[model samples]
Target: MSPNNDKETPILPWDHFSNWVHAICVVTFDLELGQAMEMIYPADRELTERERTNICYLAFPDSNSGLMGNVQFHFRIRQCPQSMNAHTRPAIHTYNSNCPTSIQIEDGYLYGYVYFRQVKDRTLRRGYFQKSVVLLSQLPLVSLFTAVLELVAPEYFETGEASLEAACHHLDQWPPPTPATTLNLPLLGTLIQVRIPSRQDKPGASSLTPPSPTHTMSGPPSVLIPTPHETEAFRVLAPVLPHLNLLWELVITAEPLVVMALSPTTAANTVQTLVSLIAPLRFSGDYRPFFTIHDSEFREYTTRTSAPPNVILGVTNPFFAKTLQHWPHIIRIGDNNTGSPSTQKHKLKKASALKTVEQKPGVYTKYRPHLQADKGLVKRLLKGVQTGRPVEVQSALLRRHLLELTQSFMIPLERYVASLMPLQKNISPYKAIPSLRPFNPDEFLGTLEQHGPHLTSGIRGDWEGLYRRFFRSINFSAWFNARYQEVSDKLAELHLQAVCDADLGGWVCSRSEVEVVDMVLRLRSKLPRAASLPPSHPARDKLTQHLHTLFMALPEDLRAVLHAS
Candidate 1:
């Protein structure tokens, strides 16, 4: 049953994806105010001081690629702005420039999906044309939103307000965030057919495969996460490829990891990809794709002696290299100056063996990768790049390889977890509830000798070493707790069932006379029936009949006292 609390779960009036897009604001860099929202289309109502401040600040990212390029980032509003009447917030309106320079969130959920761009231009006084197209919504659909922005933002930059108005209206026609359904969204002279993942779906549960033949769909799906399109996936994974094994361990163990990239787009996307790597087993940890110095907990996150445990932060600014130097695990990606006469996308310069004073651009880890890298997979990826294969095909290759690798380890864990369930008959209400037997690493590893990673994957090495270390991590603790609680709750439910189904009459009769009296009184305490009720409740009647049976079997003196009561 859904909770009755309105703040926790608002009853939204509008149901489509269009309705969730509450505002389409354009943020620009002003010499005076660091960032300001200049235009808000269909200015439905004036934004209060708090709304303007937060919207403008978050709309434009704190840092950039340093080079001219379009970048993307997401902003999370802890609460909605006060003026946003949740029930009426249907279409997104741009932000206004009414002298206010800050923004604040309200009491509900909201997010800002921004497409920030910077370019060297002679017309602008700052010697750069800096602006961001922001879509304010009640959800974060990064993969889909990023794709849409890639198409809309450049045109909006060229056509200005007119383009934004058309795009916003077109987006207004988009359906709600429904998973397992195909959608054809029309915008800017193109009809796009794709199945988008639901923001509500757990990671790894969102299927990328074509629907089974028995399941019909309108058409094939398009680029999705866990495996993004070749360019984005390559950009995200390439910088960390040499340390892929180490990175995987970090994510698997749910360690604190910070990704430093030149672009917030890359930083945030990489964070999202990291969480998705070990899909099916959700990463039960906190993560921020783009962490801003202006965020409320900026001090807590940056100035802290250690990065928050199991928290992943992606930051773009070089300043973080020094600010977050104390962080234990970091992946700093190489920046690609895309516009610098470089036609090739994925080229790399030699990585510094240590963190750079400015922006270190490689995996920063002393942790050894227990497993050997699959030279075959690396060869395939490099061969495709050398031969100039389609980015989608190459991205798919990496995606498939990673997916298989994840399954190789996860299957055994699933089997082990299932094996832990106690037989229903073993559950007893009269005694201590049974527990899932402790996980003995040695015993479990013994099973791995037969059905382990080597049988399922081409990549092979110290699998035992990997699992042993994993048992010590907080990731295992969380995984165990979640599964343990579930099994414990099931055991409780089974106990109740066993109590209800037991031969209460025979069991009670076998006990001493004193225990029978106590047991009857205890059973009666559970039946909260009013004496005023007309003599029958199914629950009360059963207990009454059992009492009568006990009375007939009881000593005459005890029966007389029970009958009198």
Candidate 2:
């Protein structure tokens, strides 16, 4: 929308730095430069010094690696305006969908999908190879983008830039990344079918769609999330499944939590999955799926005197066990290989001290969950697996229960908020505008006098205390603020339309001297357009001549109102 931007420039899906993706980067460890970004794909994206430095560092953030294989993880980086081409301005994915849900990006952030690898090689002087294939994008579909990289990065590892060119060529043939629609995109001679979820869609309300379906269904995109709970993210949660209710409480309440796992992939995926738990409700806390000791906020996050910030960190280094000990909650995880290949099993227990040696996984927390765990659900899952039920269905079962639990907790609040909308007759341009009713915790509780929030998951208890606690939480604040802004905008639009529709002469005749002056002041810029109209016209005469006469006729005492405003 800037005057300097080239509006006529056509935006293509594989433009190297298009809206779908910003760059396909290759970051490598140099002999002297430490972590370095060796290539910016398409070779046309000339990044600023700040952007280059940030991508090189943030894309491959870990400072210590104990393994010599590829470990895929996700991270977010600060967006640099100077590094962006004008065609990359925020806009719809395409003109065809007419879908209003575009990329939901904050002011200065970009999602990074990284496939970091370390391998043994004799060709290098260090006798080892370290590099990462990075996909930088503005979209928030972490699972979708990571899956795309999985199919593309393997070939790039072997053929280098030629693979990227081939990938980009194929990417150009694919459809735009539009939400609320199912896209059948072709990549490396394979068709990837995924349905992007809308912000309004609730989890568990629709069937879970796998990445590769047995047959393509024809129709509008199903109402669902991009990825199901039947992913590695859920498998990572297996270690702490028994403590899930507590995990939900901690996450929804915005408490600082850490995901500890032996594999960086597990740690990062778990963190991202936890962040996505409050689907339809945005997470407003800082999170680092892949945290490093040398990160910019290391000192601030680990200082002994400070209370732990409301954040989520996924760490592989054993050093965090001692460093983040003072943190409120910790969910330690282990490899998912405790039993047969058909089942996912892991060991975890409550511990006074974290396992510093990085062996088995365990939960270390003193705070109790508000609602008791739904033990029956766990039993049913185990029972189903015994009867040859698809174990993959277990994640969906747990996922649906959690979604319903969250929705139940929010239903009363949502109902109460709906009542805050002013009666249509109460809104008028001639009168002082009214805003949505103020949110009062005690008053809000009065509406629940007959009954408290009911959980569809069947977990029950006195959750009044939890409701009170939620009003003070960042999640509540964020959700309420969003509602408040939405209502405020509605009121503003109504007022503007009403004012525009009102008769100018009749409106002026009913106005006070001060109101007349205020209206004239606001209309000064528009007066020229009215003057250009035919003199016989109603709006032209009233808005130009009659309004000017009324404003000029105002007393000196009333004219002072203009100076004050």
Top lDDT model: 2
**Candidate 1 segments exceeding 4 Å error:** 1-12, 15-25, 37-55, 64-70, 75-111, 118-129, 136-140, 150-175, 185-192, 196-231, 337-360, 428-435, 438-447, 485-565
RMSD of 1: 9.3
Model 2: worst 10 consecutive residues (lDDT sum): 94-103
lDDT minimum window of 10 residues, candidate 1: 95-104
lDDT tens digits by residue: candidate 1, 266-366 = 77778877876665455666677777777665777776755466689888776777777767777776666321112233323232334453443556655
* TM agreement with the true structure for every prediction: 0.68, 0.81
The TM-score measured for candidate 1 stands at 0.68
lDDT of 1: 0.63
